[model samples]
Target chain A: MSRIQSVLQALKGQGRKALIPYITAGDPHPDRTVELMHTLVEAGADIIELGVPFSDPMADGPVIQLACERALEHGTSLRQVLEMVKTFRSRDDKTAIVLMGYLNPVEAMGYEAFSDAAKAAGVDGVLTVDLPPEEAEDVAPLFAERGLDPIFLLAPTTTEDRIRAISQHSSGYIYYVSLKGVTGSAQLDVDDVAEKVSRIHALTSVPVGVGFGIRNAETAAAVGRVSDGVIVGSVLVDTIAKNQDDIEALKSSLVNLLKPMREALDELAS
Target chain B: MSVKLTEEMLRALPDTRGHFGAYGGRFVSETLMDSLMQLETEYLKLRDNPEFQATFDKDLADYVGRPSPLYFAERLTRETGGAQIWLKREDLNHTGAHKVNNTIGQALLASFLGKKRVIAETGAGQHGVATATVCARLGLECHVFMGSEDVKRQSLNVYRMKLLGAEVHAVESGTKTLKDAMNEAMRDWVTNVDETFYIIGTVAGPHPYPMLVRDFQAVIGRETRRQSLEQAGRLPDALVACVGGGSNAIGLFYPFLTDESVAMYGVEAGGLGLSSGQHAAPLCAGRPGVLHGNRTYLMEDENGQIAGTHSVSAGLDYPGVGPEHSWLKDVGRAQYVSVTDDEALDGFRKLTRVEGIMPALESAHAVAYATKLAASMDKDQMVVINVSGRGDKDIHTIAQLDGIEI
Candidate 1:
């Protein structure tokens, strides 16, 4: 099994939910990313979703859009992001890392080259936000050949038939968008997402992790009750945005915010 | 002579999954797949229903002033010094552009779908004004997103859209142009999928949009076919139109795709030169990639990030073209070229002085090429150029260029 499967299965075996934190790879400063990745793992982050910035991030709301702008201001390329992964892998090899990005950059790098590079850099999964299953027919298999988990998203608006179709190509886990609209745009309704998650579980064996608008520990706990993993974005990126100048304070702020969520998920297991 | 194509090839494209050969599949986040599927189902049903199509037609005829004149440009023909040249006066449409043709159809569909609000994104502001005008007529709420740069550039059309009562939003992200406006509009549509309809300004975007907008705008080619025969005793030997997202060119070219005797030319904006990496001629100078929901020819860098596009005409200043245009280019069905900012400006001045027709800067690109094309043909042959819009909105840009504070 891949690193992603091994980690998620271990969490399920322990009856504890996984905590996934998303951060743009080159945000605040390019040199700070690998250290940040290590920091997140130290703060009880079960998995890391590293955003590779694209010029136009269609699925992102304003907060993450600004994050992209800041990341790109330093001339962060896809190759540089993979290098960061390599750097992070040098120190830690246990925590699963998923590269999250749009399609054009991957297409620019060519599918075979990207898959090879990503796998060599110790990437466990890839979640291309803009590449739905219909377009991933060729790409998913290429990624699979390199032993990388091809992750896909299922939204509340997705029909059951599409859910089944998307699940067939997905490995590792399916990122379930809890609300409509772009990322970080709406309030999450736990009951509704719970109902949808149950329906999805009825169809596919792939685990579902809930994300989009899981902005705080309360929301994360609420979502953890219904999902295999809880994803926290926008809020953490917002924190980084607020504390760009002070690296020590930024790491401290991330730890203080994320520790409670870890405690909350543990409390649920108890 | 054109390559022989089957009738099926002409009628059947974008397959069921929205692929045009290797291009034009729906590549979007999962949040939008269901909505796009819903739209496709509705459009498929509405396209064949006689009443729905009839309503669309009556609105086109009565509201949008269809059957716009196909005038013989005698002076322009004489100046070009070769073949007879004619102008398809899309400039005389209700909104002073061919953009209304598609907007009217989409607005009617919105009404049929029981949508209460309509949204659109624009660059030069013609499409926004066109969308706002149709929404005003149908009594639906209207919202238009335009990039801040375009808002400042096309202030006149911006005022026109506001006067028509649309809620105009100035998109301030990602190069601050048509692409950003489109990104914002998609956000709004996904946010309000149940109550609102997105009337795409061009034959771009996701699957059904390209097909839907093309069908609405096909009236231009249909009329040109009839008018060419009526006025010139034969089908025109050549067709020319400016291409941004390629709505107008596709509109005029779709019906004539089966006419193997006729040639088609699509003019793209060449801001400085292709070598300078400062132009917006995607089909002419760039490579194919997925952007704004479909796979198409796009101006992108080595890293696949969309590049900043420059053009004298705001409407042509976009990074990507319609997916079908990409397919057309690959199939050898259409020839795509570029005109410099200076050449387009000369075409704008020449048409205004000779024919008393002040063409939009976007359309002027076509005029610049059509004159050279006409000069290369025999006097007995005819060329039809789509004057896609009027120049009333561009007078200020021209005046500023001339250093006259008009």
Candidate 2:
């Protein structure tokens, strides 16, 4: 089975939800990034989403926005993020690693080259926030050939037709945004999200992971009850922003924050 | 009397990464990386050289006419029923705009960098004219990239640039507008990084650029500050200016950002209305992203694709803003708002009739905002507006709008 499938299967057997924490690679300090990645994995993160910081990130909220600014300040590029991933994979292989960001950095690196480099670095999947299903057609197959799942976001505003289109093109899993606005806005209706997930599940066999407003343990638990997985970004990004200067403190805080939701998912699964 | 720069102030200007408080830094492609580094090194060397400073200062005073008048607009004040209004007559500067202030500075810097040719991209053609003028004065080879649509609409500017011995290339790719022109210019710069100097028209773009442009344009505020003290015996209560890529606005706003009592207003172009989706109000409608170098607010789609923006004034039709302006907006140091195209047109006509001033459509946005703002405020307050450029080139456009051939 693929790395993503293995993670999903492990979750099913344990009757627990996967905790995915996202941190922009090379933020604050690149040297400590690999250590932070390992720390996050050990801290109960089932999957680690390493954000390749782009010069432009339209979908990100303020928390991730600041993180990107910090990362870009150090002259971090796609090459640096890929090298960091290579360093990360050298230590851990079982933890499913996904590279998440906009398409500019990848476009700047070219598709074939980026996919080849990513696979070499042990990246398991790719989730470009700006690459829609139609555009994904050009790059998705190349990634699949290299064993990298191309993830697509299914928004609340995404029509049924588009959802079907996204599902047909999507690999690994589907990312369902819970709100209308960008990542950090507050209003998230659990019932509305559950209904959207059910609608998506009806069309696709792949697991649906809901994100974009699942900030805390309660929301994660609530979303986890219906959805296959809960993807927490802004909150984890906020944590990294608050403790970026102190990596140890950031790791501990992230672990503590994810432990409750992970435990909550266990209770629901059982 | 001369104002000498103290060591502390000069050191405080450029930040650790060569920024002016989150405003400047080099964000570039690998092709021009070495060129930028060399330019940065040369710029640093020439900045402290006495010969360069003397030439720059002398040109500002004699040619561009330093210490531009701070005339109080008594009639406009009485009509608006607001504070006493004062105008910094940068529009009276040679080349008919404030763009000359930075063009002259960069032209000199280009020469110092041993660059044989100067290249620039223009939207409203103000910067093109300014750069061409300087290139003529300095005997440098000049090339300008303008959007094809702009070349057609702003034909007079194209002729003027050519007359100044500058080659004008009309870009037809993408939107065939300012942003596309900028991309084309960058591509050229990358191709000819060794022999050419890219003269950015606005306070946007990657690193030292935002800081460099602001420094060159700061002459407006510096002169305004001195002239205000001379004419009004004090600084004004508020300052108003138009923001395209925010060069003129930043030029006027930077000196006043630290002045708590001087309210700074940057008027963005609302082409039709905010709801019409035809505006260039980046701060209002855009989110923070990286484009054209430094991180700033930009108008982009969900997939982070840079969207083509709309503005009646070609100068204001950009997807992103200067990084410093973004930082200022975030800190609430200045207020950024929008004025619609109709309102700008009204202001343009009103200024022509009342003040005998044919203001550029870009500058009219500020005038429109100022007109509305003045009507609501108390008479005791004082306001200073940066009359950034002239509207002579816009006569044809204005005539076309009125269904009359110019």
Candidate 3:
């Protein structure tokens, strides 16, 4: 089984919900990424979604877009991001690591070479923000050969036909964008999310992880109640943006920032 | 060369999935799939509806001034001392360019789709102004996303859009130019899928857009085909048009696809020389990549990151071209070349002084290439160049270059 499947299964067996935290790999500073990965694990993250920064991240809002800009300013590339995953793997093997990015970088490296490098670097899964299932034909089999879960995004606008098509290709949990807008653009409506999550459950066996517009413990807990996982992104990246100059304070605040959401999710699970 | 394709065969392309032979596809986020699917359905329906065709036709003739004259350039031909040359007067459209043709068509579609608001992204501000004009005419709300850099460079066009009552949002992301403005527009479309219609300025973007924009703008080529036979008593030996996102070029080339006797050239913006790494000639120097929701030839770095493009013509300063152009280039139905900024400037001056016609900077690139092509051919051979837009918008840039404040 892929790391994502194993981790989610174990969490279900233990009757606890999963907390997935997203961070851009080279944000603030590349040197501090591995350390931050460890910090996120310590803060009760069951899975880590590491953003491989692209020059143009259209689906992302201003917060994550700025985060990508910061990460790219230091000349961080896809190969470097994979190397960071290898470093994090040396310290922690239990937490599932998914490399989240746009398709161009992988296309630049070619599928076979990227898959080999990703697997060698200990990446468990990948979620290309722009590569929907229709275009994932060439890349999907390569990831499967390398034992990498190819995650897909399902949105409020996705039809049942599309959901079925996506679920067939998606191996890791499907990311459910909770709102109609880009990341960090809208307020989460828990009721609507619950409705959509239930509809998605009817279509696929894949675990649904709700994200986009998910911020703070209250929102996370609300989302955690309906979905298998609550994936938080722009909020964490915003914290990193605020404390980029102070790495020590950045780590401390990230731990503090995630601790409440973890506690809130655990409370619901219990 | 690929198979010799007739116009029917060419139009049959983009298939159901919008693939123009591995060139165009709806490579977009899932948030947009359903919306694009809906748009595809609506477009496929209205694509053949008589009522839709009537409205589009009437608007093209009355509002946009159709059959923009195909004028013979006697002085240019004499000066070049080569082939007889003709100019397709797209520069004389209502909005001073051919951009209004597509916007008027899309605006009517927006009305039919019951969309209350329309959005567009522009590089030269011509498309933005064109879309804003249509929206103002139809009483629909309009929002135009433009690069902050372009906002500064083309402030007059920005004011024009505002005068048309459109909101101009200056995008500050990426290279802060045309490509970034497109990204912002795509994001807005994904967000406001239900009530907003994205009026893509060119024949790029995903599936229906490339095909739809081409269909609307094909009036240029359709008219040229008849006009060429009438004026020249035969098909022209060569056709030339500048290609930014390739709308004007494709529009002028589509009708001549089956007429294998006519040669075609698509001129790209060479900001400097090709070796200088500053030009925006993707078809000439770049490789194929997926961008702005379609697969096309794009100026990208080794890592697949879109490279910053440079061109004296703001409209041509984009990394990617329309997918159909990529297909046409691969199939060898059309030849894609480029002209440097200096050469295009020379073309601008030559046309103004010799022909008494002020061509847009983007159109000047075609004139530059056409001059060279015409000079190589016999005088009996006829060459037709699409003067895609007027030079009024480029006057400020020209003055700046000449060290004179406008």
Candidate 4:
């Protein structure tokens, strides 16, 4: 089994929800990404979502957008991000890392090359923000051949037919955007998310991880009740934005913010 | 050598998923998929309905002043002393630009879809003004997204859109240009999909949009074909049009795809020069990548980040071109070239002084290329250029560049 599937399956067997934290690769600085990934794992992240910074992140709200800008300013590329993942793998092998971003960089690198490079770098999965099922038919198989789980997004506006199609092709986990708008949008209704996530779960066997609009422990706990995983993004990036000048403070604050959510999610599982 | 494309074959392109030969597809977020699919279905139904066609036709004839003259440029011809030059005067259309053609068609579609609000993104404001005008006429709320830098440069257009009862939002995102405005507009559409209809002003974006915009603007080429047969006694040997998102160029080139004898040329904005790295000439210097929901040639770095693009003309300051243009370029059906800012300026001045017609800076790129092309061709051959917009909106920019206040 792939790393993501093994990790998710193990978590399911333990009756505990997966905690996934998303941070833009090379944000603040390129050298600090490996350290942050380890910190996220230490803070109870079962699957680490490392964002490949894009110039235009349409699916993201202001917090992640600013993170991307910071990462780009520091000269972060898809290749550099893979190198960071490779460095992270040098000491650790249990934490599953998923590279999340838009599809242009992958297209630029070509599918076969990217899949091979990702597998070599120990990337367990990939979530392309703009690539829907209709566009993923060509690249999905390439990823599967490399044993990389092709993750997809399910939103409030996604239709049942589309959910069926997306879920059929997706593996590892499905990211259910908790709100109708972009990431960091405020108005995450826990009841709405619960309803949609259940519907998604009925259609596919892949674990559903709720993301977008998850800001704190309460929301994470609420989502963890209805989901197989709770994925946090903007809050962690927002914390980094605040402590950009102090790397030590940024790492500490990220851990501080994630720990409560981890405990809360664990409590629900228990 | 290019294959002879039939009218029927060309019209049947962009099969169901909106793929224009591996270029165009619906690459949007899942939230916007249902809306786009609904739009495509609605468009297919309305595209063949006679009543819908009649209304669009009526609007083009009565409201937009169709059949804009195909005038022979006697002075420009004499100066070049090669190909006989003709101008398809799209500048004569309502709003003084070809952008109104697509806006009118989309506004009608929006009304037919029962959408209460209409949103558009613009760079030069001609499209924003045209969209606002149609929304005011149709009694729908209108909003236009523009780059903050464009808002500062084209303040007059911003005021014009507001005066026409549209909300003008200045997008402060990446590079603060047309691409950023489009990104913001897409975000807004995803949030308010039920009530809002996004009227993309160019022949780019996701599927159906490129095909739809090209269909709306094809009136230019259709009219030119008839007018050329009447005045020149034959189809012009060559066709030239400026390309930003490639609306005007594709509009003029679509109807002539089967005309194997007619050569086509698309002019891109060369801000300074090809080597300067500060230009919007993607077809000439950039590579293909997925951006703004389509696979097209874009000004991007090795890491696939969209590069900062520059152009003297606000309308042509985009980092990517339409996917159809990309297909056309790869198929050798058309040749893409670039014109420097100074050369386009000279074309602007020459046309005003010689033919007594002022052209927009965006259109001036075609004019500049036409001059160079005309000088190299035989005198007996004929060339027709789509004068996509008038120069009134660009006076402030021209004056500023000339070191004078308006």
Query: What's the TM-score of each model vs. the native?
Result: 0.99, 0.62, 0.99, 0.98
Residue-pair clashes per prediction, in order, are 0, 4, 0, 0
Tens-digit per-residue lDDT, A74-124, candidate 2? 867778888998988888888888899876567556689989999998888
Tens-place lDDT per residue, model 3, B1-406, is 6458786777678888898987898888888888788888998899899999999999988988887999999989999999999999999999889999999989988999999999999999999999999999999999999999999888989999999999999999999899999999999988888899999999999888999999999999999999998988999999999999999999999988888889999999999889999999999999988787888999988878788999999999999999999999999999999999999999999999999999999999999999999999998999999999999999999999999987
For candidate 3, what's the RMSD?
1.1
Put down candidate 4 lDDT per residue, A1-270, tens digits, no spaces. 989999999998989999999999989889999999999999999999999999999888878888999999999999999999999999889999999999999988888989999999999999999999899989988898889999998988889998998899898999998877888887889999999999998999989999988889999999999999999999999999999899899989999999999999999977
Regions of candidate 2 where Cα sits further than 4 Å from its true position: A1-270, B1-14, B18-24
Q: How much DockQ does model 3 earn?
A: 0.80
For each candidate, report its DockQ versus the true two-chain complex.
Answer: 0.85, 0.02, 0.80, 0.79
- Please report how far candidate 1 places residue B177 from its true position, in Å: 0.3
What tens-digit string does per-residue lDDT give for candidate 2 at B6-70? 45654575564555554445544333444655666777788789999899999998999876788
Report how far off residue A5 is in candidate 4 (Å). Answer: 1.2
In candidate 4 the C-alpha lDDT for residue B7 amounts to 75
Interface RMSD (Cα, Å) for model 2: 16.1
Model 3's CAPRI class is high
